[model samples]
Target chain A: MEYIFHITILISIYGILALAQNLVMGSAGLLTIAGAAFYGIGAYTAAILATAFGFNIFTTLIIAPIVAGLIALGIGISFARFRDDYFLLATLGFLMIFNTVVRNWENVTGGSFGIAGIPKPHIFSLTFDTPFSFLVLALIVLFIVIGICYFISRSSFGRVLNAIREDEDALKIFGYKTSTYKLMVFVIGAMLSSLGGVLLASYITFIDANLFTVNESILLWAMIILGGIAKNRGALLGALLLITIPEALRFFGFPNEIAGLMRQCIYGLLLVFLMLYRPKGILGQYKL
Target chain B: MKNILETKELIKSFGGVHAVDHLSVNIQEGQITGLVGPNGSGKTTLINLLSGFSLHDGGSVFFGGAERKKITPWENQIYNITRTFQQIKLFDQMSVLDNILVIITERNPFLALFERHSKYHISQAEDILKQVDLFEKRFHNAGELSYGQKKLLEIGRVLAMDTKIILFDEPFAGLFPEIIKKIENIIKALKQEGKTIVLVEHNMNIIRNLCDHLIVMDAGKLLAEGHPEKVLTERVVLEAYLGE
Candidate 1:
């Protein structure tokens, strides 16, 4: 039962991350690779506040997203001039810098040793201590993120984003400040990803630099691509599939020695097949 | 008639060559001004300059009798100046109606987040689609539209802007005759609404039929200007542009 809850909680967490990433990469057509960096910023913010400053989970939740959003604003403004591959490179560079900071900022982040013993979330007398309780919390946050993504997808602002993705210059000729729209969406995605980080930190009661690396960011991208781009249900479906597949592989009774490698091989093959047959994923409306 | 748009000694250069070199021109209000020139004769360059797609290296552009310092597409749109591209740019991923709605939708990003397209906006988009004869395909994706339909959608988007001055760059180059006639009617209707229009094209027949006043260019300078019939017969315009 605990194991099932654990898997469900992970799905919920990754579902939020996928939805956030979809808004930037799928909806807005920004090829960003720094999702893990923002996620890590949230984790570290919560971890440091809980461990060093003695702040609670709720406080960290609010502050962490704000911090990540501010950083995203700076990045969006500075990188506004870059397009296509250049934008991708700029975001990748930020991810590298963020990784370095978390690994070397010994005083605040605990460097490579990491921080642990994060208190589970609580409001008043209710504490999300057990896996079941935390699963409930994660599900609630996931639903909220889903609702936000849905609202954005239905609004006039969403239409503008679609226009931007298709032809930003043409949107500009229609009097849209394309740079401003890009910046706004970038900040919104970063802030939501930070919320996912907050949940991960408190749920596990520990966080380290390894949890938020370029590989992790790429995994988020893979989840979105496999499920569907620009589709909220696709994002959730992607997170669920990617999270459950490895665990399902365990039941196949492969030798423990080669199990991890075999799982990787199967994962790569699955993605390759999906790309070959369904270039837009299972339910994608747009192709990058 | 008052000049709705005027350029004074305008200069735009690429490396050592001037695309629009020290060229001065006037676009009169409520008049269809045709810009005709040979290839590499600064017609499109002048449109780019006027529409704020490209910046000038020297001289000034005066709109509504005010000397503009700097220009950007959105800023010009706010000043009631809009344009269409030669390549027929549209929001390909959006639906046909959405391509028009995106123009008429709210500009405030925050307010737009909560605001659904009002009934007025939907009706407005529908009217534009009806005008362009794409009303039946309103729900189809813009990218799925045929080339001629895409051109119509592009024009429909510009109409949604409801601007005072509209600059069209080669709007009829690849269009079918019926589509060209449709666009000709649209331009004539826009002039009837008291809008200023600057059309850049190579079709002499269309130019002679649609243009109220014609300005001819050669090598980035004004080669001739007058009624299309009189200017078409000018020896310099004939030799430099008409290839007579």
Candidate 2:
């Protein structure tokens, strides 16, 4: 029962991250691997504030997104000069730089050792000490993110993003400096992903550099692409599938020695099979 | 009475061949100017340079009769100088109404964050769609439109920009004659409203019938310039097209 709640919480947290990923890749037509970096930024920012400055989870929840947003703004503005693959490369650069900071900044981030014993979230007299309570909190955040994504997908700003995705040059000639829009939305996606990061550290009660890396970024991309792109419901379905399928394999109770390896092989195979058969995934509209 | 746009010795080249060599021309405000030339004579190149899609190797484009400055393609969105491509470019993923509505967006990106298209914007879109005969298909995805419909939608997008100077690059090339007639009326209406248009076309009939002034080019140099009827009759133009 507790295990099911834990999986539900994981889905809710990652569901938000996948939605953030969808905003950049699915709507804005940007393929990036930098989401993990901002996610880490949010986690570490929360971790540092909680342990060092004695800030509570709620305070860090609000502050961490802003911190991550600021970092993305600086990086996004500088990298906005690059387009297509170069922009993708720049996102990779940001990922590496962020990972290095978390790993080497031993005093602040605890370096490779990581910050552990992250305090679970609490508001007023209510405490999210159990998996079920935290799942409720996580669901609230997920719904908020969903509402915002729904609003964005229907708004005029969303249409502009759709335009940016389909025909950037046409949008530019019509008097919109597309690079500026790209930067703005990149920052917004980063901020939203950071919220997921905040939910992550508090729920897992542990933090580390290894948890946020380029590999994890790729995993998030796979989630969105597998479920779908541009659609918020796709984000939910993606997070559910990617989170539960591996845990379901564990229910088989395979040998501990080969279990991890076998799980990885099956997971990789599933992605390949999905790509071959349902290239658009279950709900994806975009191929990439 | 004053020239709205003047190019002084504008030069562009590809590898070693000059595409537009020391070319100079002036366009009066509130009139339709026809730019005609044989293939590769640089009509499209001039449009590119003026609209900031491509940079010229040398010379300057003096607009509003003064202030010679370098034109940056990305930053020229505010210049109200816009163009349509030789090949029609529209936001194919958006609805035809959205294709027009996106440009009519609030200049303020902040306000546009949550703003749905207001009644004013919708009505404006409707007006342009009706003008281009795409009102019936406003909700359809632009990519699903027929080729002729795509051209009309592209022109509608240009109209939505409300730009002072519109560069139409071969807008009528692949259009059906019936659609061409519609575009002809639209152009005539634009001219009547005093919007300056530089039409790059290969159709001599369009040039002769619609253009108030005409400039002809050959091998990256001006071959003739005057009223359309007089310029089309030039022996040099006939030879430029037919070859000596």
Candidate 3:
């Protein structure tokens, strides 16, 4: 039961990240590999603030996304200069830069040894110290994030984004500053990814630079691709499917060492197959 | 009538060859002006330059009264100048209603974040779609529309923009005769509404019937400009079209 609860918490967390990725990749038509980087930033910011300054865990949760957002705003401004495929490459470069900082900045990130003994989440009289309780906390945050995403996708802003994804020149001819729209969504995506990071740091009660690697970023992308893009409901569905597939793999009784490798292999193969055969994803209306 | 648009020595070039060289013209308000030229005669290039899709090497373009410098397509919005592409450029992923609704939405980012399509905007979109005879396909994806319908949708987008000066780069090319007639009616109606129109067309019959004034170009320079009835019969205009 505890193990089942543990998996549920992970889905809730990954579901948030998938929604963030969907905002840019699905809605805005930008394929970026920066999810894991922003996730790491959120975790590290919260971890440092909590351990060093003794800030409340819930307070850091609020601050984590904002800190990551401010950073993304700066990075996203520069990113606006790159278009289409070049933008994807630039994001990959940014992911590497963030990874390197976390690995080498030992004074803050603890340099791969990772920051351990982090406390679980607590909200005033409530404590999310147990797996079941943590799942509840994560779910509350998830619903809030989902609601926000739904509003964004349905609003007039979303229509413009859809227009942009189709024909930027046509949208611009009508007088929309496409770059500003792109930047706003990119930063918003960063903020949402950071929300997932905060939950993950608190849930695991540990932190590490290695947790946020290119492979993790690809995994998030694979989730959105498998589930669908442009819709938060698709994001949630994808996170659920991806989170269970690995655990389902564990049940296959594969060799201990090969099990982890096999799951990654399956993820990689699925991404390629889906991209070639079903670029729109299972529930998506638009192709990446 | 005052000129709503003016180009002073507007110049553009591709590689070493000039596409538009020392080309100057004035477009009067409330007039349907035709821009007719042979292939590679720089008619489309002139529209691109005026609409801020291409940068001129050495020249100035004046819209209304202010000089526009180093403008991009989106910036042309402020000058109330809009255009359609020779190649159709509609949002294929969006519904016909959304194609117009997006333009109808407020340009202010904060306001648009929460803004829904008001009944007024929807009715306006419906009216414009009706003008293009596309009200029934308002919910259809633009990509799925027929080629002629797609052209009408593009024109519908321009209507949604509600700009003062519209530069059309062959809006009639590749469309059916009926669709062309509908567009002709729309253009004529827009003229009645006091909009300035610059049309680039290859159809001489439509040019003769629709254009109030005609401007002819050959190898990047103005060949003729006068009343269509008079300009269409010029010996140079005949040679420019027939290559005598």
Residue-level lDDT of model 1, residues A1-288, one tens digit each, is 999999999999999999999998888989999899998988898988888888988888899989999999999999999998899999999999998988899888888999989889888899999999999999998999999999998998888888888998878877888888889999999999999999999999999999998877777887888888878888888889988987787788877668867656655776687778876677787777
Instruction: Label model 2 with its docking quality class.
Output: medium
DockQ of each: 0.79, 0.59, 0.79
- Model 3 C-alpha lDDT per residue in residues A1-288, reported as the tens digit of each score: 999999999999999999999988888888799999998888888788887788777888889989989998999998887878898899999999999988888998888888886777777888899999999989998998898788888888888878878888778878888888888888889998998998898888899988999998999898888888777777888899988988888788887688889879988998999989997778877776
Q: Cα RMSD (Å) per model?
A: 1.6, 2.1, 1.3
TM-score of each candidate? Answer: 0.97, 0.94, 0.98
Better model by TM-score, 2 or 3? 3
Least accurate 10 contiguous residues by lDDT in model 1 chain B: B69-78
Tell how far residue A225 is off in model 3, in angstroms.
1.6
Residue ranges of candidate 3 with Cα displaced over 4 Å: none
Best by lDDT: 1
lDDT of each: 0.89, 0.85, 0.88
Return the candidate ranking by TM-score, descending. 3, 1, 2
In order, what are the TM-scores of chain A for the candidates?
A: 0.95, 0.95, 0.97
Best by DockQ: 3
